[model samples]
Target: MNLELVTVLVLALIFVLATARSVNLGVLALVAAFGVGAAAGLSTDEVFAGFPVDLFVALTGLTFLFGFAQRNGTIDLLLRAGLRLVRGRVALAPWIFFALTGALMSVGAIFAIAVVAPLAVPFARRYRIDQLMMGMMVVHGGMAGAFSPLSVYGLFVNSFLAGDDLGGSRLGLFLASFVFNTAIALVVFLTMGGRFLLGRTEDLAGAPASEAEAPGQTSGQASAQTSAQTSAQTSGIDLYQGVTLLGLAVMAVGTAAFGLDIGVLSLSAAAVLALMRPDDARVCLANVSWSTVVLVGGVLTYIAVLEAAGTVEWASGGIAALGVPLVAALLLCYLAGIVSALASSIGTIGVALAIAAPMLESGELGAVGFVAALSISATVVDVSPFSTNGALVLANVDAEHRDDFYRRMLVYAGLVVGLAPLAAWTFSLLPV
Candidate 1:
C-alpha cells in the first residue's frame, strides 16, 4: 500500500481499538502517530510538529478559571441566577446555556465549549436535566454563532474562500449556520426529552435528593443532590468570587473585543483568580482537563502527519471527482462534519475549504451556498466525545459519571454525524 493509504488505515484502526476497549484514545493516537510517521520515513520532530501548544495552554487556563469559579461558589451563584431567569423551570436551562455559549462564540471565540461546557454540565446535573440534551444544546449553540463576522471560524472560512476567488455572501454564511443549528437544536429539544420539560416546574434546582434517588444513579439524577447541597450552602458572593467573575469578564472582553490572544488573556485572568484564593489553586489545577489536552494534541498531531504524508490531499481529490453538485455538496458537508468531529474544529474549516475549492471553481455549485454548507457541517459536530467541546463536557462531569457521559456523547455525536451534514447542505441552498 502507498504510505498515505497505510497511514489512513492505521488511523481507522486506532479508532477501532480505542472504542472496542477501555483505553484513552489519546494514548493510542500518540502511539499510532509515532509508529506511522516512523514507518513513513519521518523523524520524531516532524511527527511532533503537529502538537497544538496554543490549544494546550488555552484548555488548561480556561479549566483553571472555571474550576476556581466552581470552588469559590461563583458557579452555583450563576446557576441560581440562570434558574431565576426561567422562573424555576428546569427545561429552560438548556436554552440559557445554548444562548450564553452562542453569544460567547459570536464574539470571536471558537472554543466556546471551554467557557460554556464547564458551566452547563454541572448545571444540567443540578436540576435532573438530561446531560446529553443540555451538553448538545451548548455545543450546537456555539456552532450557531461560530460563523459570525468576528468569530474565529468565520474569518478563516471567509478569508479562504475570498483568497481562492470563490466569492460568497458573509451574511449568508451566518444565516445558514443560525438556521441549521436552530433546527438541530429544535430536534434535540423535542426528540431528546425536551417536551417533558415544557411547562413542568416540579423539579427545583438544588433540591435535596430523595430516598428514591440512588447513590449509584448513573446520570442526571445522581448529580442533583450533590449540586443541591453546594447551592444550599452557598450564600451571597464574597470578594474572592466577585474578583473571579471580574477576571472572567476581562478574559471574555479582552479576547472578543480587543482581539487579545485567548491563552494569554485566560492565563492572566487565572493568575489573578489564583492569587485571590491560593488555597484553591491546587484544586483549580486538578480540575483542568488533562485528558482533553492529550486527546486533542495527539489527534491533531496525527492529522498533521496525514497532511505530511499526502493522505488529506489524496482524499480531497477523490471527493472532487464526484460529478453531481448537490450530491457533492452533501458529501462535502459529511466530510466536514466527520473530520471536524474527530479533529480540530478550526483546522477542519481550512480543510473543508481546500477540499471544496475545486468543486466551487468548476462553477457547478453556488459558492455562497457551498461555503455555508461546509461551514455549518464542520462546526456543529463539536459534540463528539473526542472533540474538544465534547471532551470538556465529559471532563467537567462528576468523576463517577465520566464513563457514562463519554458514551452518551459518542452516541449523540454519531447521530449528528449521520444527520447534520444533510441539514447543513439543505439550509445552505435555501433562499436567503
Candidate 2:
C-alpha cells in the first residue's frame, strides 16, 4: 500500500486497539507516530518535535493548580455556598448543581464531574428529584463551561487553530458551547421532573447537617449542627482557600487582560501556592491528571507525524472532493460525535479538527461556527453511559435503581448521539 493509505489504516488501528484494550489512546498514538515517522523517512528530531510542549504545560499546570483547590476543601466549600442560595427550594437544586459545575469547568474540565456527581446524586434522592435528570444537568453544565479560554477543551482546540493559522474565535466557541449546552440542560430540567420540584421545599431544618457529622447524631442535634456549620461556612473562608481564590482571579485577569500565556500563568500560580504550603503541594502534585497529560501529548505528537507524512492533506483532499462544503462539515461532525461517545472526546477532537483543516481553509465555511459545531458534537455525547461522566453518575446511584438508571442513560445517550450532531450542524454550521 502507499504511504497515505498505510498511515490512514494505522491511525484507524490505533483507535481500535485503544478502545478494545482500554489502553490510553495517546500511548498508542505515540507508538504509531514513531513507526509512521520511520516509514516516512523522518528524523528523530522531527519525530520528537511533534510533542506539544505548550499543551503539556497547560494541562499539567491547570490540573496541578486545581488539585490544590480540590484537596483543600475549597471546591466543596464553594458547592455548599452555592447550595445555600437555593434556601431549601428543591426545584433549584439541579440548576444550582449545574451552575456550580459550569463554574468549576470554566477554569478546567478535569474532575469537575467527579467532584459534583456524588453530591448531586444524593441530593436528587433526598429531594425526590429524578436522578437521571440531575446527572444529565451536571454533565451538561461541564460542557457549557468547557470551552472557556482557560479550559482544557478550549486550549486544545484553540491552540490547534492558532498553530495552524486557522481563523477561529476563542470567545465565539466558548459562547456557542455555553449556549447550546445550557439549552439542552433546560430541556432536561423541564422533562425530567423539574416542573414537579417547583414550589416544593425541603425541610433543611430536619436534614442532616453534614455527611461527616450526620453519623451517630440525633435528628434534632443534626439540625442544630447543620445550622451552625452553614453559618460558619458562609461567614468565613479558610486562609488557603482565600489565597487560592485570589490566585485564580489573578490568573484570569492576567490571561484575559494582559494576554499572558495560560500555561505559564497557571504554573506560576501553582508554584506560589506550593511555596505557602509545601506539604499540601506535595499531596496535590500526586493528584494531577498525568494520564490526561500523557494522552494529549501522545495524540498530538501522532498528529504532527501525520502532518509530516502528508496524511492530513491527503485525508482532507478526499473530504474536500465530496464537492459540498456543508456536507463535508456535517460528516465530520457525525464522525466526532460517534467516536467520542465511546472513546476519549479529547482524542476524537484532535483527530476531527485535523481532518477538517483543509476543508476549513477553503473559506467556504465559517471557522468559528464550524469549530463550535464540531466541539459541541464531540462533547455533548459524554452523557453516554460508556463515557466517564455517565459512568460516574451510574456508579454513584443507589444500588437498587442502578440498573434502571443505566438503561435510562443508555437510551438518552442514544438520542443525543442521533440528534445532537444534526442539531449542532443546523444551528451552528447552517448559519454560515
Candidate 3:
C-alpha cells in the first residue's frame, strides 16, 4: 500500500480509538489529514482544498445566530417556556431540554450547543438537577439537530452518496427518521428516566420563587434575569427579528433566491450578522467556537486526501473480503458514533460515511440498512466525556450535581446504543 493510503487508514483507526479515550479526534484527524497530504508531497493548497468550506461557513454562521438568540432573549424565552411546561417536575427536565434543543436545531443546524450551554448551568443549579442529565439533554439535542437535514452532517453524508442508488440518502426520509428517533428518545427520557431520576425537591432550589412560588413567574423571572445579564454585559439587539430574519433569509435565499448551498448561505449569514452590529462584533466572534472551526478545516483536507488516494476504496474491499458487508458496515457506524462522541458528530460522520460510501454504492450493503446505520452512527459523539455538549455540562455542573450528569449519560448512552442498533436491525430485516 502507498504510504499516503496507509497513513489515512491509520488515522481513521486512531480517530475511532480516540473517541473511546475521550480525546479531541477532530483536531487529531485534522493534523493527520494535513500531515499525510504533506507526506504525499501534496501542496498546502491541495491539502487544505479538501476541507469542507461550505460546512465550516455554516457552522460559523450558526454560532453567530445562536449568539444572537441567546443575547436577544430568544433562547431565554424558549428556556422559560420549557420550565413552565415542566412545572417543577425534575424528572421531566431532561425531556424538556431535549425538546427545546431539537426545536432549535430544526431551525439552525449548529446552534444547539451554543444555545443550550449557558442555560444548562443555571437550569441545573436552579433545579439542583443532575449535571449529566443536563449534559445528555444538551448533547442529544444538538446531535438530533446535527442529524437533521438542516445540519452539515446530513449534507455531507448526502453529498458523498449523491446520485447513488442508496435509499438512505434521501433528505426528507433521513430527516423523518431523525425526528422520530429524537421524539422517541425524548419520551423515554421523560417517562422512564424522568420518573426515577427527576422530581427531587432539592433540585429546584436554584430558583426558589421561580418553580415553586407562582410557576407562571418562573419563565418571566428566568427571562428577566437572563436578559439582564446578557444585556448588561452587552448591548441588546432585536434577537427575535435578527434570528427570524436571518434564519428565514438564509433558508429562503439559499434555496430560492441564490440557489446556493445551505452551508454557504449559513456561513454568509454569520458574516452578515456580524457586520450588523459593529460594537457587538467582538462579542459575537468570541462566542464563535473557533477551535471547532480549526478542527474541521484540518479534517476537510484529510478526507479529501483519503478520496484522492483510494484509501477508503481499499478499506471497503477489505470489509467485503470479510463476507459480512452489512455487519461490517453496521459495526463501522457504531465505532464512528462512539468516536464522534469525542470529536463532535460531524467529523466522525464525515469519515465514516466517506469510507462506507463506496461499499453502499457497490451494493455491498443494502440501501435501507445503509441509511439506518448512517443515522445511528452519526450520534455517538453526543455524549462522550470530551464532546462539546459534554464540555457544556461539565462546565455547568456544580459539585453536588456531578453524579446526576454521569447517571443520565449512562442512561442516555445505553438507550442510544440499544435503540440505534434496533433501528438498524429492523432496517436489515425489512423487505428491501
Candidate 4:
C-alpha cells in the first residue's frame, strides 16, 4: 500500500481505539505517529519534529495564569465588573464575550483566543451559562474578525493574492467572514439555551447574605448561594491580583501590538506569578489541563506526519485532476474545511488558494467570491476539538465537565464539517 493510504488508515484506527477504549487520544496518536513515521522511513528526529511545542507552552501557560487568577479571586472581580458593565443582564453576557473576542482577533486570532478563552470559560461557569454555547461563541467571534485588514489572516490572503497576481476583493473577503460568523453565533444563541437567559438578571453584588443563609434551599439554590458567597469574598482586588492583572495587560499589549510570540509571553507572565506565590502556583499547576495538552500535541503531531507522507498533496492532486472547474471548486472548499478542522486553517488557505490559481486565471471561477468562500470554509471549522482554538476552550473548561464538553465539541465540529463548506460555497461562490 502507498505510504499516504497507510498513514490515513493508522489515523482512523487510532481514533477508533481511543474512543472505544476511553484512552487518552493524544497518547494513542503519539504511538500511531511513531509507528507510521517509521513505516514511512522517517528518522526519529523528523518524527519528533512534528510535536507542537509552541501549542504546548500556550496551553500550559494560559491555563496556569488563569488558574492562578481564579485562585486569587481576581476572576470573580472581573466577572463582577463585567456584570456591572452589562447591567446584570445575564442574556447579554455571551454577546458581550463575542464582541470582546472579535475585537481582539481583529488584531490576530491566535493571540485573541489565547487571551479570551481562559476568562470566558470561568465566566460561563460562574453565570450558569452553557459551556458549549459560550465556547463556540468565543471561537466564532475570533473568526468573525480574523479577516479584517489589520489581522494576520487578512494580510496573508491579500498578500498571497497580490504576489501571485490572482485578483480578489479584500473588502469582500473580510465582510463575508464577519457576516457569516455573526449569523452562526446568532443560531448558536437561539438553539443553545440562550432564550432561557433572557429576562434573567443576577445581582452584581452577591445575593443578600440573609437570603443566601436562609434554610431549606434546593441543591441548585445552594450551589448559587455558595457561588455568591465566594464572589462576595473575592469582590475586592488585593495586591497579588493587581500584579496578575498587570502581567495580563502587558502580555496582551506585547502580543497584539508588538507581534511578540504569545506562548512565550504567557509563559513569562505565568512564571512571574508563580514565583511570587509558590503555594498558589502549586495549586494552579495542578489545575493545568495536561490531558488536553497531550491530546492536542499528539493529534497535531500525527497530522504533521500525514503531511510528510504526502497525504494532503495526494488528495489535492486528485481534486485537481477532476477537470470540471465548478465541481472542483466545491470539492476544494470541502477539502479545505475538512483538513483545516484538524490542522492549521492558515496553512490550508495557502494550499487551497495555490491549487485554485489555475482555475481563477482561466476565468472559470470568480476570484473574489471563491477566495472568500474558501477562506471562510477553512476557518469556521476551528471549533473542532482538535484545532488550536477549540483545544484552548476545552483546556479551560472545569475538570468535571471537560469530558462531556469534548464530546459535544466533537459532534458540533462534525456538523460544521458537513455543512459549513456547502453553506459558504452557496452564499459566497454561487451568487458570484
> lDDT at 12 for candidate 3?
58
lDDT of 2 at 89: 84
TM-score of every candidate relative to the true structure: 0.68, 0.94, 0.75, 0.64
Please list the residue runs of candidate 3 whose C-alpha ends up more than 4 Å from where it truly belongs after superposition: 1-5, 9-31, 38-45, 81-96, 109-111, 120-135, 163-180, 190-259, 267-272, 411-415, 428-432
Model 2 lDDT per residue over 329-399, tens place: 88999999999999999999999899999877878788888999999999999999888888988887877
- What lDDT tens digits, residue by residue, belong to model 1 across residues 1-432? 788779768876876676567456678778988988888777999988777676667666766666777678665566456656777676776887788777656644445677677667665675667777888888889888888755556655665566568888777888788878888898888888888988777444444212114324555765555565664455677788788878878877786578676668777878987787787898778777676567666766776677677776776667766756678778778877887787655555654666566667777677888788888778788778777678777777777777887887788889888988887787546433
List clashing residue pairs in candidate 2: none
Q: Indicate the TM-score of model 2.
A: 0.94
lDDT of each: 0.72, 0.86, 0.60, 0.75
Q: Please give the lDDT score at residue 378 for candidate 1.
A: 81
Displacement of residue 241 (Cα, Å) in model 4 is 1.8
* Preferred candidate (TM-score higher): 2 or 4: 2
Q: Cα RMSD (Å) per model?
A: 6.3, 2.7, 5.7, 7.3
Candidate number with the higher lDDT (2 or 4): 2
Which lDDT tens digits does candidate 4 get at residues 182-300? 99999999999999999999863443212232223455875676676775565477779998888777776886579676567767888998999999899988978677678767866
Q: Give the clash count for model 4.
A: 0
* Top-scoring candidate (lDDT): 2
Models sorted by lDDT, best on top:
2, 4, 1, 3
lDDT of 4 at 139: 95
Question: Candidate 3 lDDT, tens digit per residue, 252-306?
Answer: 4565455566656655665565666655657877877566666666565677777
